[model samples]
Target: MPFVKTTWRNSISFKVLLAYVAGVGLSILLIALGAVALITSRSDILLTTDVAERTHELAGKLMFDVAGHPTGFDDSEGDRVWTFKSLGVEIGYRVLDSQANVVLASTDEAFWSPVAKSPPSDQGRFKFEREGMLMYAATAPVERDGTIWYLQFAVSERLMELLHQGFAWPFMGAGIVLFSLVLLFVFGACAYFTLGYALKPLREVSESAAAISPRSLHSRLDSKTVPSEVAPLVSSFNSALERLEQGYRVQQEFLATAAHELKTPLALIRAQIELMAPDKTRDSLLNDVEHMTRQVQQLLLLAETSEAHNYSFAAVNVGEVVQQAADYLQRMADAARVGIVLTGHTATQTPWQADRSALFTLLKNLLENAIQHAPEGTQVRVQCTADKLTVRDWGSGVEQAQLPHIFTRFWRGAHRRDHGAGLGLTICQEIARAHGWTLVAHRAEPGLAFCLSPPVTDSPSMNSSQESS
Candidate 1:
């Protein structure tokens, strides 16, 4: 699996959650500003309420007659209404009877007979002239028996400033801060669970996409389980897989046909040369033809091994395969005056999941190559363990730089013998890859060693440790 890097800025869920948070913050700021504006716009009403409350307290202190006229002070004159002045600001008030005649005035400023109006039921403010300055005033009705009296109070700019500084701004600021904190908590919690649920389909789609490879071309994305927004993309990818599978099949068929066409003619040419008299020129031509035939055969095997779908996986006995390869290559070993030695358990000892014919071919090629390079009297050692097969030749090992190129198609090292086309290791590598195995070369003291083993990357503990890290 390949690693994919994701940051908050690049993630869709993170960006959406960020947008959510931004919208919430904007709304709170707007509401706070609107609250400030509302208080500013309706300052008159707040002022009126403050004045009316104080007047009521003052009204309770005075004794009134049945006609709504103040008779005398209910309390001592030391606590009179005139002494109750606003902080840093002076305010004035007038007590009027039903006939609009002033019973008392805080200051004798422009004493005039204004229009007779009834006191309002709801709290409100009104404007009137006090000498030349503009004053905000409110009228509240005072009831004595059945008669009504009006208490009107006036306010100054200084009083409004005092209200803002004393209580209004502080209370509103605290309220907005508290509200914002609560909204942040709720929104954070909701975003976590909601985004997790919403993006689950996308995560599933990612896992399904990861499962796709050349071997699983027949499989398709489960578009029905994905989000509607991503369904089209998954469908398109499945369609691309279909096209790739067809193209691959066509290429494989062509290779097969070409190998078949070349093989028959080579066989006929070899038979014709065999019928001719034996000579040096004839022997050289035959050798060249034999090499060409071997290359063609290797090419076919390479094509088949490269195709993932061609191999049938089963419980292949590792020991049996190794012995069979050694036995089949015995004649070649004898011809080269080299011995084949195998040291492992019985045939049915180990069962590995692999393609039987392909495994046999891999072992045969390794053994044959080792025998070819092996010293005349030395032994080609074959070792089979629980999970691996090691083939070593006691010949001059390849140079360090040449090790990496051993499995390359048609690449031959300096120590590699014969005029053979070099597709054996490449085929073995392809077979190992198809079966999820690892084929590696190592220096075996006096010679070279080729190891075929199962891949160790799929362990659950290793996966967990990797993820944790």
Candidate 2:
């Protein structure tokens, strides 16, 4: 089955959207927590302070009764007549001496306790619990004729409970409403900023990628529009596009060269056959025809490497493949008076996952090119490791200036000694690319050395040994 290809639109946009949503959601959550904490703390402090202040004021007013007259502190007439109302609840006051006694009391006995002890002179406020009821009182000292008097104000448990019930819900409700509105605003703001700034660069990248085509593979997204977090990705993509554009140009040139090379051989063969005579030279003519056919076949192989879908991958034995390619080119090497040698130590039975036919074609082309370039009586060495194949010849090596164009189609060296097509190295490079391998040519001791490494695979230990002899 063919490999399933994934596209940028299907992957990148969804990922960006997901990130934006996550950022907005997290911001809203944090804002809601902060708002809840702030609102609850402020409400508690305000309610507590307000209640304390009211209790203090009520205690202050009752102190004047004790100072005005000595008999005013009496339970029948003094500060006992005064009442304090706040937040729809009424409170009453009284005055007492140091002893466990009531100098005066309010209208309701439950509100003012006869047994309630007087507070210390320095005490400002106190709480009393009786009959499962809670009461609040604030005590203040009153200066009389010669002794100190205590003015105490008390409020009923029911009134305090009513005040709490009234204040709690509204404050809580306001806090909740405020928190909700704040969350809404935060979410909206995050969505706007995330989409506007964060996602804007990604959208521009998408548009730039969409504008790129095979014909314009050199086009790249503007680096300024890329976010710092995504800069590496953009840089790597542009680098890949540059490599692809170069590969495409090379393939186009290779196709044109292959077409020209094939036409020459076909034209020669046609001309020779068309002018053939039924004579004793038929055998020699047939040999020439076979030679021409071989050349045409080699040209076809080179053309196939440049084409898009000319190779496939399968399990292949590296040892046997190298030997087969060597055997096929052995006669040609002998004819050129070049010695071809193959040597390495690896498992001959081990198999690799690669395109077998393309591998052979690649090896054959490299060997033929090496033999052709090498001088007479030179040795062309072919070595194979499980992961790499190397071919070296003992002839004048390529010059530094010509090295760059060694793999370029139809690029011939300055010291050319033969009239042959120069698509051999170009075809080898293309096949290496299709298999995701590397093919490099460099100067050896006396001649050129071409090397091809196996493509990198997920399983590193699959074939780590050499296989050449």
Candidate 3:
């Protein structure tokens, strides 16, 4: 029952099917009731008509016998009554005088009830109960020697009930069974096919939507083939996709244009600032200028990385890339008072096919970011393995909740920013993605660790190209 209730609540198709079945079943039940009542009423009317005719016939016979015998049962009449009783005909008869007393009866033991009072003159038939038995009676008036006698004939109520039940019960049972069978056959097929046909448009809409992606934003949902009820939703979704694509294109264009437009002026400003006298103020101004310059460079890199430019892949040694990145950041590491260590190096480390410049940029960003974030006098260890490299630092690690947001562009956590643009990790992520590699950050006990692994390639290939600075 609970399962049925839940299904009815959650499933529209189930509810629809149930509604149809319930309505049809209820209709069949009411129709069967009406049919049974009509049949029973008609049968009772016919039985009453037969009782009236039999009562009159028996009255005539009884009057003729009484006229010959004067006051008692005749031998021929008695024999006829015994024959009917032997046949199991359960018929009772009595003759009443003008005073309503039973003067004569067919039964010797007084099975026939005496008339308690005079019946209404218009009442030719009536029903009554006596002792534990129900009975139906038909009456007629007869003249015998100038005295009026009431002749009464009765039939058993139990017999009448048996006749009605015997006919009505089987007919009703068969009707219900036939209705259930027909309902199952007709309703099952209609529900299955109707629901399938109705949901086909929704299924098509889902498949079409699933096939769309960033590369295929131009695709639109086909409203023509969908149902009228769902076409509005598909139209709205297509409109939303159009707006999103336009907004994305506009953002990409703005980033590219702004970076290109700001590069030369920011560079010239830096060169001019460097020629000034050396002082604390000068140093502060120079630091700010350098920060701005780095931001612009990062912005340009972000724009380039986001585009659909084809990057050249090549065979590059992971150890060589790590060493180069660490060496290049030696000055920055020294400035931060952090030491860079290289370990786990061995011969026969397989060189995988990847973009050399992209790998360098990736390693450089990771190493620099770790060094910048690590405490002074702490070491950033660069560990190399068969197909992966990890840079571990000893500093306050990122909060567990902030880990996911670290890879997003320009996102900063609860850490000090020393002229950091917050794009370093994001850039590394993009480079790794472009080269078909994966970069993941982990919360090392002392600090954070970043791991890089190149995706497996089928063959060894070598090529070289410079990355945009």
Best by lDDT: 1
TM-score to true structure, per model: 0.70, 0.45, 0.57
Candidate 1 worst ten-residue window by lDDT: 460-469
Q: Where does model 1 exceed 4 Å of error?
A: 1-3, 6-9, 18-124, 127-171, 346-348, 375-378, 394-405, 443-446, 457-469
Look at candidate 1 and tell me the lDDT of residue 427: 86
What is the C-alpha lDDT profile of model 1 across 243-298, one tens digit per residue? Answer: 99889778878877788789999999999999999999899999999999999998
Per-residue lDDT over 255-334 for candidate 3, one digit per residue giving the tens place of the 0 to 100 score: 98998999899888888888999999889888998888889889888777655354566567878888888889999899
- In model 3, state the lDDT of residue 182: 82
Top TM-score model: 1
List runs of model 3 lying over 4 Å from the truth: 1-175, 178-186, 189-204, 207-216, 222-225, 309-331, 334-360, 381-390, 413-417, 428-442, 451-469
Cα lDDT, all candidates? 0.75, 0.66, 0.74
Q: Model 2 misses residue 326 by how many Å?
A: 1.4
User: What's model 2's lDDT at 122?
Assistant: 52
- Ordered from best to worst TM-score, the candidate numbers read 1, 3, 2
lDDT (Cα, tens digit) per residue for candidate 2, span 135-166: 56566666656767676666655665456556
